[model samples]
Target: MVHFMSFLIAFSLIAVSGKASSGFLYPQFYDHSCPRAQAMVKSVVAKAVAKETRMAASLLRLLFHDCFVKGCDASLLLDSSGTITSEKRSNPNRNSARGFEVLDGIKSALEKECPQTVSCADILALAARDSTVLTGGPSWEVPLGRRDSRSASLSGSNNNIPPPNSTFQTLLTKFKLQGLDVVDLVALSGSHTIGDSRCTSFRQRLYNQSGNGQPDNTLDQSYAAQLRPRCPRSGGDQNLFVLDFVSPTKFDNAYYKNILASKGLLNSDQVLLTKNKASMELVNLYFFGGQLSTWPTT
Candidate 1:
């Protein structure tokens, strides 16, 4: 089994052995080692996204979850074996996270082209950017040279990745712990513009949020009414709803627009507007930014 120690060793070697420029990742990390690495990853990611549009969102979320747990080291990709526990079973993952098969396919293709030359960590980062682009989202140059971890962290996965029910301040603190600020939180939350959330993820808001039996007051009553029949108080845990009701598959700022209108899907999402002034301003900025390019780059 791949262990966390192996990841540390790999990262240490790169940092100390001068394999990467002063230990920092760059877009050109694979230029000499495997010239076609990025192209291969993008091709595989494009094919996966074509098969199922939601796969793009799944892949993007997968990278986010991975980065949160272990600094984008691909610890999330390790499978369970012996004493090593897989992060897949963590609270934020389990039935919620996906797109592993897509990663496997990309890894297989890369191995054939250049055996062990590309790390799964870098594959995830590249696939995430490609997935975003394939889904009509913004494109950015991803820094490469991340090494795959040999171990997974179930505790870190659970503790680090914020849940759908997290309060606005809790979510902000969680992002801050990872060295991200309000701008990053709001910008990254724009990913919700393209994905689906399970019924269980938001059902608490529909039936009894705050233990009050009444639905969350922040949720638009009409929208909540529309959701209850399909989501229900029980069963349908796996039933899916678009995170962004409008432009569900398009990677735009519709998520912020929805939140501004009290139509955001999850408690965590709606709280961005309801619970904090800074977050509300970010939401407004993205809602009116009109395009991904216009949103804050910081």
Candidate 2:
């Protein structure tokens, strides 16, 4: 599982933080201007994760959502102004998106070191890599030099991000629209190994998953029962449950294991096993051990 996660995580990062040329981005982009730039990001992220381990996953998720809509451009950070509508107001990010304060700290420190030398988009990438390492996941060399977008995309955020209740095919199509493949989808979804999902995110699985008054059969009955009290059929929407109950604070393959055991918390997760043959196979590959021809390196 560890071996596979190392590969998946690298793919997750590389595939997400992708815009690099024309503008010319690289790992060494900050070498001369602010040599301590990456370290500052790591330090801020380390402290945040230490204070709240879930911050690691939150940072990572923030990176993914930001990059998906605007190609790692930090448009996700924008607030509504004259004509700009903040992505934060979108359905996908509403109450779920977080770690902005930690990001603000990193940005503030970087400005002190060298004003505007590091971009928020690059900070997102570096913090995500740092968060992964802090949470027992692999590291990747993040390409820097991504410029923050001046605009936010509310419609894009609402339409692009795959919702928690997305069917397997819907998830794949959304990923594909972002230039990601089946492999990237599976790899990135493995990030569910850490973090939490709000009751509102997965409440449908607990009751009336298919429009009928019944829980999702793929979700283990016992697990649903445990979730029902705090995550009733209605309300209690903000309550959070660990995505991977086995190692909630660690970035590992336990998420895939939970799916294998029919304990996946969200419909999107459980559908990987119950709805798609290829996705199910990938889940099994990630859960059990597997061989890789070549691993991604820094």
Instruction: Flag clash pairs in model 2.
Output: none
**Residue range 1-298, candidate 2, lDDT tens digits:** 6786678769767877966323977889999999999999999999999999999999999988887786789999998999899999999999899999999999999999999789888899899999999999988888888888998889899998899999888999998888887777777888998999999998888897558887777889998999999998778999999999999998888888999999999888888888776776777778887654443211
* Clash tally for model 1: 5
In model 1, the worst 10-residue window by lDDT is: 13-22
Model 1 misplaced regions, further than 4 Å: 1-22, 290-298
Model 1 Cα lDDT, one tens digit per residue, 42-161 = 998988888999999999888888888867888889889997899999989998889999999999998998998999888888888788778776666677776778778899999999
* Model 1 global lDDT (CA atoms, 0 to 1): 0.80
User: What TM-score does candidate 2 reach?
Assistant: 0.95
| Model 1 lDDT, residue 205, Cα | 92
lDDT of each: 0.80, 0.86
Clashing pairs in 1: 2-150, 2-151, 3-150, 3-151, 4-151
Which segments of candidate 2 are over 4 A away from where they belong? 20-22, 291-298
Query: Number of the top candidate by TM-score?
Result: 2
Candidate 2 CA-lDDT value? 0.86
